[model samples]
Target chain A: MKKGKAHVLKIFDNVNTDYIISGRYKFKIANMKDLAKYIFEDIEPGFYKKISKGDYIVAGENFGCGSSREQAPWAIKEAGISAVIAKSFARIFFRNAFNIGLCVVSCDTSSIKNGDVIKLDLKDELVINISRGERIKTMPIPQLMRKFLDDGGVIGHFKKYGDFKI
Target chain B: MGKTIAEKILSSHAGTELKAGDIAICKVDFCFGQDGTSSLIIDSFKKSGRKKVFSPSKFCMVIDHSAPSPNVGVSEIHKKMRDFARSEKVGLYDIGEGVCHVVIPERGHVRPGSLILGADSHTCTYGALNALSTGVGSTDLAMTLISGKNWFRVPESVKITVNGILRKGVYSKDVALRIIGDLGANGCTYNSVEFYGPVIRRLSVEARLTISNMAVEMGAKFGVMEADAKVAAYLNENAKINKGIEGVTADKDAKYVKIKGYDISSLEPLVAKPHAVDNVAPAMDLSSIRIDEAFIGTCTNGRLEDLKIVSEILKNRKIHKRVRCIIAPASKRIFSEAVKRGYIKTFIDAGCVVVSPGCGPCVGTHEGILANGEVAISSANRNFKGRMGNPDSFIYLASPATVCASALEGKISDPRNHIRV
Candidate 1:
């Protein structure tokens, strides 16, 4: 659980992986740090340069739709985003983000304004809009998903357990 | 409670009767990764500090995306995948082999009632055979490669029944697009779709493959149909099915979260408009919209029947000089069969560019990339913005028949008036 300023990309519904990181950058690069520079490069040129560390992204429904590109979440995590709040997410993307230990919250983000400095307590499953004096409840992360995130991604989970045990 | 096909399969694999949303770790029969995602899987596998894979035979790396190396960077990625496969003693399907979804089933690697995973979204394509297949990210895939098992929250089942006979010129592609349109992109999110009906059972194996391939487009964990005579025949002829197919069907009393029915008796050709797959409309309604390119090949419609129809349409006619027709067979087997059947020769004579068996232009990796301001009528499942390359370019998803007619007319034309019965 943590509090942070929201730096919204304000994208529409069904924000696909291709938009997050173009296919051109998929196989051409190996290191996610290098690949992070191209995240959302097509949709908003220099998006990586603009987002700050620990910033949260509020988006519409079905965010991270399209392609099973792990780079999508890797880039988002590498971009220093602490959390992503969307109305819903594509199942694969939801799994990918959790496997990488990226915080993805599902809630109605209609009232969240860009740069609202919202505070999030994931353990309590709550989002607080400090500037707007608003408090929103978010869906609870699944029990198994929280375990994976707690261990800092699937790799870390495996290292700690000797196997991916829930 | 009687279990649906999804539940039945998952229960069998989990060694227990499971209901929807119950989290459990299930053993995987087989798993694969395409070149696009395999690189990441390798990185994760090494990072996991594991030496030997759980099972070498069950794991494989496919190199169909950006095959033959579109550039030096892509070629280097392929080299890395090849080296990893060698070191791990896992299977490798190199470039020119075919799309992973097409080749895996064509080679008989998939069996009814099995659980398969791939690091690509379209892994659900194997669900055509009543297998519980779904996509996962590379990190999950890497974990599976190391342990041969992964956790899953059993998804609720949605029963979609298609009845009635289809009219000529109305193909399975139209049926799939119609389903997506009816159930928006995320309508089936996190749910397994169980397709049943006389019409679906009657469809050829290739047609079943076409339908299941787009299951992900509807946000389904899997779009599956029972293994019928057609599926059994395909498996007996091409693949080794060690188990009887009788146990794969959904029980008569199977529970469904929802049931939707569609009659294809009066179904017409459908097209998914630009930027979204669910933005569908009748093909006839968009006839006036001209196209700059026509792609007649993809995992969705690159089978032998697709090539046969495309060649029939373009046999004695030249494509409109303004339209660039690009045709690629989904796999090497299909490519060779099309060539042997003279379909490839006809396609070439009609001014179409035939590439090797792989997913090229669909992912904007290689061959036939559309420039900005261009409009393309494609047979691929997705038509998202810039999915085929330039974001400024537009893509319309349609059947191979519609794509061919549009290629000849240089516009988004319907195939009803063109194809002869």
Candidate 2:
């Protein structure tokens, strides 16, 4: 069982890749750390400075809806976001997050408030909202994805198994 | 128990019987990346310590986004792609070749019933030819590059059937925007959307490409159409492969999670408002919103057919003096064709700046970045905030005809009032 507490940073629906990291910095800055500084610069200015290493980003439905730019998830992970809790996620963003070892929790984030401290219990598939004393159910992570997360993403899995191991 | 097109394609590629929700490791027919995502793909490939791509002939790269190197950093990234292409013996389309989505099909890399992948979201454009194509992130693409295979959770299917003919001035883009508006942005997430009905049969290949191109905007995994004689002719004429023309189709009793219908005979020209692709409304209704720039190009509406419509409208008239109209052909082949057909000259005479064939001003890298508080209209797929560079600026999405008409009026206007389409 894996458990951790993190403060929530609330956002809205359909937060696209451009909002997470603008296309202007896509080619100009190759370093993930440098790009992290500009995460959510367009939608939420100075977003990187507000979060600590284990903070959670809670968003509405269809988060990360535009573009297949891995940089979007990379920036979020590089900014030290522990997990992104949302009602839903775009297909590519969901796959990319798992590929990069970013924790993406799908649940009803409507009850979660900004700056709320929430505990994620991965083994129980529950989001314990310590601030409000509520325990919400999360979509169970698939066995393959759980394995990918254990190995720190597809690259780590590949390095260990020499194949996708699908 | 019949299989949908996606299930059939994935099952064949995986060499096993499969269904929706089943995870299968399938062989990839073709895979590619663009400049924006190719750098990360290369880095991931290098980090994996993979000495060679799974199949050089089956893979390629395009330098369409931020092409011609906007700055030193981009130039270095292009150099890396070139170097990697040289060493790996994979095909590389440098600056001016065209957008990856357009260039790949014109170069015969796309075919029916094939499973294609790319690092760019609009890669679904090839689904017009009946291929199971979708976009992926850099790491997944790199994994495919190394192993020539990727896993997929077969997506449930959605059947969208359209009846009746599209009215004059109402192009495929309008129909697509209408459907996207109805479905919302996340309506089709993780689903294979199959387009059917009589209306699809009459649309030209380019028009169908326009529709499939925006499927990603609705979050569809694959937006495919049934291949027919037109697709066969296209493959024969362009791809030069005539024998394998019998493309796959869904089973007669194929299951679909949802079915929606549309009749476009009375559908008016549509536009997606700023900051959201699904915020669609009739183009004429938004005439009060003035525009500073008018762009007519991208993977969605940058074909010769689109340019012909723009030329017809802009032939004898100059655009509004205040509006900066930019036109870009989707590929070099389309560029030469437009030049031969005199569309380029008509555009130049109409005071439009015709740039080289590539994804210009679409990705907000260069060519036509918007200023803060400015407004622009384009024929591109997405109208997300800051999509054209400045977050404060606004963007509206429409068809090329609408964009051209709006260019003439310096505001969002209807194409029907400008010309008889």
Candidate 3:
């Protein structure tokens, strides 16, 4: 069971992977940490300076919709984002986040406004908006994904066990 | 209850009876990675403590994205890929070979009823040959490289049927954009979409590839079409594989989560507006939108047929002086074919620049990057913000015919006005 206050940084719908990290920087910077500085640079300039470590990014539907570039998730995680809460996530981005151990929660994020502090309970699959005094339910994480997160991503799981336990 | 094509393929690959929503570990028939994702794939493969690829022959590495080294940083990555490919003795498609999606299928690596995976999202393009193919992350691809297998959750199926003959100048790219517009960005999230009907059967294999390549835009896991005589003939003529020519099809009573139909007889050329692939409108409606560039290339519309269409439109006329028209064939084979057909000469006569066979500007790495406040009419997939390197610039998606027509008019124009029915 884990619970914490997540500071919200809101964005609009259909935020594609290209906006998260521009394709120009994908091969230009091989290091994930260096790539983190350009997160949301295209859509939201200076986005890297707006948030602190452990902050949560709340967005509308269809988040990370374009490109299977894993650098998008890597940059977001390296930028110190704790999780990405949205109404829904694109298929490839959803899978990539889990593979990298980045938390992606799906729920009704309409009522949660920007800059609101929300309480996220991972075990309960609940998001309590402390500012709005509202409770929202998120889709349950699959058992295998939960295990992957517990092991700190697929790489860590591979290190712990020679092969995937699946 | 009958099973869909996806279920049939996955169950056979898994060696067990599996249904939609079931998670199973299945053997991959073929897997690949490109320069954009291979670095991470290599890192993960090494970190996993694997010494050799599970099946070096079954795996391949391609250097299409950022090919020929656009910068020093990218050059180092290309060198790394070359070194790794040599060390592992795995197959590698060097720069100028073409985009992975186009080269792999052209070289006969794809077959019907086979399960394939690649590190690039457009990997679903192989599904046009009736294979079960989808994209994966670097780590997932790395795991497949080490184990020769991966896990999957069989996705529910969506049946999209298109009937009636398409109108003149409305190519498969227009059909794809129309369907994607109707489905929205995440309409089929995590679902496998199967295209059917007479229109699909009549389309050439290259046209089908265009439709399947954009399936990822609608959030579909796999976009597949039924294998027919055309696919068999293509494989026989290209790869010489005669066995397993008859591919799998959905059962008569197969279940589908959704069924949608479109009559393309009345369809007109369409274009997806700036920043979103689903923000589609008629080409003529956006004629006022001026452009700085007109690009015709990428896995979506860089084949010989597409180049021929552009050449036919630009045969006796020079493009607008204000527009920079660029054309690239999807592969070196297509390049030579275009040259032999005199299409390359026609493009040059029309003042269009022809680059090498590869993903030139589609990925925003090289060839043509839009400047600030510039607008481009392109035949490539995805018009996401900053997709062509300049966030302040705009990109509109259309067919090669429409792209050529707009290059002549210096703005978005209807292809019907430029071509004869």
Candidate 4:
């Protein structure tokens, strides 16, 4: 298991997933290893190859503002990134992140900037800046999402908590 | 102070007694979800610790917007939704069936007089049939899953009565774009829009859909029409549509917020300038803005009729060699019909890309997105930044006529003059 942490390299106001991953390659790549190759291939050039799992994405208002594509956050999690820190998320994106156990927090986006290394403790919703010794957040994960996080995504969550009535 | 139909519906379904500042928690009669958002919605269904769905099985999920799963991450999400729907015994789900909006109405879930809510903002597209539909966030949707209720500030009604016969080349999409541009994008926020008058009445049900589907662009909850004999006729013939449906009608003396009237009988094709749906002008007013693509599809105006309108226009003229033209039908049924009618041949003969149904270029995800510095005029909803492709790409909201004529000239030209002789 990886601790949620990452050093930010660039900050954006509202970074939609189409630019992060895109619908063009949706069918071309069918798994994490293959999909990761083109991550931000166009938008933030070199971002997909450079980012490691457990890194953090900080953004301004309405991050993930377009169509409700779960792949937006799914790609982030599978690419080894751990969490997203934003001022506020589009209503759908917030729940989608939690559905698959991705660590997402709403913080004052203006307080953070590029090159800030932060530690994310999912249990308490505490986002600790290792370098600046500052913290910011307000993510109260519902009991259900916690189960998904504990088991590691929906498949794990269901396998562990599923009711086999069928 | 005659009230619009939209006000009548919202007031009737308001659950409890409504007041000026009240944000009533209205019980939802319908809910829609798409593949782009369905997996997570289903996941939240399991995570909410809820045991079963509170809404009826008519609550649907459309596999539009990346239906084929643009990537592996998307595939996993789709699989999760399928497994959840099966395990939960959820009915009314579209498994790569078609675009959410097109499929929802095709399956007969939409009816005049019901207040429906979808996770996609464009959910209001159902208003074409005169239903009051709105879009909400997934969290609010989760609450709906648990309790079958959604909250909303009772919106004021904007009654727009049209008293003109549509010009031969003009379309319902052109009328909607003109209204949205005239009213400004946020002009109708938290408001209900009711289309009435002879023009609205005369529009074919498909044409009415073209108008109502773009309600979101005006920041409205819905663009609805009264459930008249025409609607009843449509429902009766559309296979098994939502039956036993009750309709919402205006109180004889219902209070109104605004009563705007238009005589668009002489109106020309319209366009919404870049970054704003309200920055509109007649297509004839601007001819210099060249385009790279002309798109006519999506839930807004992607039905067979909309296609026929375009094919009739494109059949006479060749597409500009410098520009690309794309028309994505809203459903497989529409696709098959167009093929049977030789409509697809007309489009292909004119050098247009006829994509399979599912939200293609309209959403900037697939189909015909514009590149940087490129411009496009579409019949689809939304002209938001980077909505079509590159953030640098400029998207103008327009009617199907504008899209077709523009495709022929490689510029945003006037479709009114291009009327087939």
Candidate 5:
């Protein structure tokens, strides 16, 4: 069970990895913290300065839609984003997020406003709009994925289990 | 209910009978990481405190993405990959070896009925040989490396039935593009696509590879065709015979989530327009659009047959002076075969820069990058913004024949107009 409160950074649908962090920066930046400075570089200039630790992102459908580059999720995780709540996600991005211990939830983003203070409760599968006194239901994270997130990530999960044998 | 091809493979690997939506933990027969993502996987694996891989023999490190590094940064990446491979004592394919997908099969690593995974999305290309293969993130790959197993939710199969033989000037690339046009980019997301029909069965293994290779464009989990006589013949020709190479077939009463049919008897050459793979328009519709560059290689269509067709089209003519044409075979083996068959000489004589066999220009790491405001027609899969270097540049996807014809005219032109067949 986990809960976090943060302000929402609103973005639109089909936000690709190239838009998250362009390919040019991929080889240029070695450290994850350095890579965070370039997240959403093209889509929102000066994004790193505007976003603080524990901030959440609210996006529309198909977020993280291009390339299986793990750096997409790595940059977001390093940027101090608590979780990303979207209507849906590209499969690769969705998998990458869980692997990196970054939280992602699918829900109706229509009622969530930019700059609104939101509380995410992973165990309860709810996104609370504390600013507007609203509570939106989120798609329940799958059991296996819940285990993955609880253990911190795939690597953490592996460390706990030693082997993935059933 | 009888299992589909994807289900059968998963069930066998899981050591239990399974159905769609069932979770199964299975041993990985082959797992690889390309240059772009291997460093991350290595980082996560080390962070997890796992000092050694589960099985060094089952793992490979392929350095195809940015091989012969373009800059110091990429060169460091290659160095890191080499150090990791040496320390881990795994198979390593260095530069000039070939694209990972192309070389893996050429080396007989992609036997039928095996489960394969890679850190690159096109890893699903192995499904062309009746294998259950899919792409994973770097962390997921790290998990697989340590545990020798990965979890999978058996995907519902979408059966695609094709009818009639394709005419000349229209190849497997056209068939794949046509499907993407109809299905759009996300139509088959998370679903397995199984190709079945007379035309599919008759297609050579290399041609079938082209079809399954592009399944990622339509968001398919795996694109598979049954291993048949043609596949057996090709495997035999390549001398890759092994007991593990037996074909796995789905039952006649297998259930499918959705079934779609396409007829290719009169299918025209097709091209995916700028910015999106599913933004497909016919070659005839785009005849007036001129290209600054034309690329004829990738894991998608860099086989010997593709090179042979390009040679056939460019035998007596040269490319338009305005267009810079580049040709790359998919692998070193394919390049050697093309050289022996005089195809490489034909390309060189026809004014095309025949680069070494690797993933050249596909990811814009090296060779044939487009400048701002430039337009390129290529045989690669995706055409998203910044996919081939400059964000402002445009990329068009087409079959090798269409790319060849366009290179000659400096515009998107139908291969039929140039080739009498």
Candidate 6:
């Protein structure tokens, strides 16, 4: 996996899987590699070839909008991406990522830039600009939640927590 | 301290008695929209010139209806809606992320006890988690965007006591369709229906959702069952299922707005002929009209369990090659679950073409659009002509078993023939 300070290249507000992996590729998703080829096909058809694993995706407003299909996040997470930083998340995608243990953070990522070396601290709830020495006012994750994420999302968290206390 | 769930919820939130037909204003926990309606609703909100929305930013918008567009026009519409939502700083969900309801709950936005409102009629599905959620019209949606509150006619309660266990090859959809068939499309106009009985508790969340989501189809303001252990179990394992909003129940001696009972033990697969939800009858009685295509997905019945039931039935069988069977999940959660569980592989192996989630063939817009004179048996909510495309395509409504069996035989065969209770 490529490693570096997470530098976001773009922030698509409402990029959906139809754009990521269009229906045209439906018959072609025999594996992850094939699925990655079509991610954001509607937005910037060949953009995946330019993305790096350490690169961040800072989306505006409700970043991962649309159906509860895990394919959208599956394609995103499987594409070697480290994390998706968004302003907010749809109810389902947010939980799905948490459940699948995908690293997704919600913060004011609107101003974060392409190639900016940003450090996301899940514990302190900070997206620090290591290069610029700037700190973003990221929403703090509750201790219980931080613990949940640290354990690698809801499923793993559940595995650790065992039975849920409703 | 001595009240019911609905009353407790309304009192805690609205700080009032919350009687039937009385309107109350409370902060919304969640809101929903999609490509087709989101743009219009947002535009309407902008037109209202409202400064702040009534609810939190936890509102959602999904692009399910016109997803993977059948035409460039629909795509353009989705684009415009997305652009507007982005500009307004509202959530803009595009196609393939997941359907609104399924995605919302998965993401933790639809926690239990939270009140929800969606632009789509099936918004009532959120009630499955104990949220006092329901659907509203475009104008009302605009108002909610501005004020976060809508006037509601707290419907007089109607108790539908469903007794007797359903026979094998039958499901909650059949029970719901049976109720719809009995109550007609407009049977319980502006009333709340509470399902009660021994068998009602046995139904899964999917089944309950299947029942409550169709409340709109029958002109019900809302359909609920007493929040019980199953609900607690779901919330315990699933989303943040809280000691959710409680509500009023019919008095033991109090008169009901309406009361209906169904033995349902001997009910047959129903086919809502065409145009209207109440235009229904026994599926076996329906003419074995040759079908061009069949669909088994929609917000109404696109869940994994719905497909699982059908997959189990079709295990040793095959869909007639002459007829196409399209199955689309309602949300990505269900789709992915089906995949992880190998149900999708099972379905494909059985010759059924699985598609992405959303309102596909059920809306007649795209994905498995039927041609002229084609007949289809589906687990979807409606059977209006031109619904599955091709005005001449006759559509029959049935449970998954009926649809699967009919798909196997290339004729409308009752699911009962394949099993014994």
**Cα RMSD to native, each candidate?**
1.3, 1.2, 1.4, 6.9, 2.2, 18.6
TM-score for all predictions?
0.98, 0.98, 0.98, 0.73, 0.95, 0.68
Candidate 6: regions farther than 4 A off: A1-166, B1-12, B51-56, B111-114, B240-255, B419-421
- For model 2, how does the per-residue alpha-carbon lDDT over B181-219 read when each residue is reduced to its tens digit? 999998899999999988899999989999999999999
* CA lDDT for candidate 4: 0.70
Between prediction 2 and prediction 4, which has the larger lDDT? 2
Model 4 shows how many backbone clashes?
A: 7
Give the worst 10-residue stretch by lDDT in candidate 6 chain B. B1-10
lDDT per residue for candidate 4 within B14-63, as digits (tens), equals 64456433456566778867765565577567666767777547466667
| DockQ top scorer | 2
> Which pairs clash inside model 4?
A5-A54, A6-A55, A26-B70, A26-B71, A27-B70, A30-B72, A53-A80
TM-score: which candidate is best? 2
Residue B282, model 3, lDDT: 98
Better of 2 and 4 by TM-score: 2
Ranking by lDDT: 2, 3, 1, 5, 4, 6
- lDDT, candidate 1, at B15: 89
CAPRI verdict (incorrect, acceptable, medium, high) for model 6: incorrect
Per-residue lDDT of B1-421 in model 5, one digit per residue for the tens?
A: 8889989988888899999989889878999998888889899889989888999998898888776788888888889889988999989999988999888887777778889989988888878888878888898998889888899888989999999989878898999999989987777888899998988877878889999999988888899888877777666666566566677888998999899999999898999998888889889999889899999999999998899889999997899999999998988889999999999988988899998888889887679889989999999998877778777899999999999999999999999988844
Q: What does the interface RMSD come to for each candidate?
A: 1.0, 0.8, 1.1, 7.5, 1.8, 16.4
Per-residue lDDT of B257 in model 6: 68
> Clashes in candidate 3: how many?
0
Pairs clashing within candidate 3? none
Q: DockQ for the candidate 4 complex?
A: 0.10
> How would you encode candidate 4's per-residue C-alpha lDDT over A105-131 as one tens digit per residue?
777757665666777766677777766
Best model number under lDDT: 2
Kindly report the TM-score of the first chain in candidate 1: 0.94
Error of 6 at A109 (Å): 58
| Superposition TM-score, candidate 4 onto the true structure | 0.73
lDDT of 1 by residue, A16-47 (tens): 89988888787677778888888877677877
Ten contiguous residues minimizing lDDT sum, candidate 5 chain B: B235-244
Query: Which candidate do you rate higher for lDDT, 1 or 2?
Result: 2
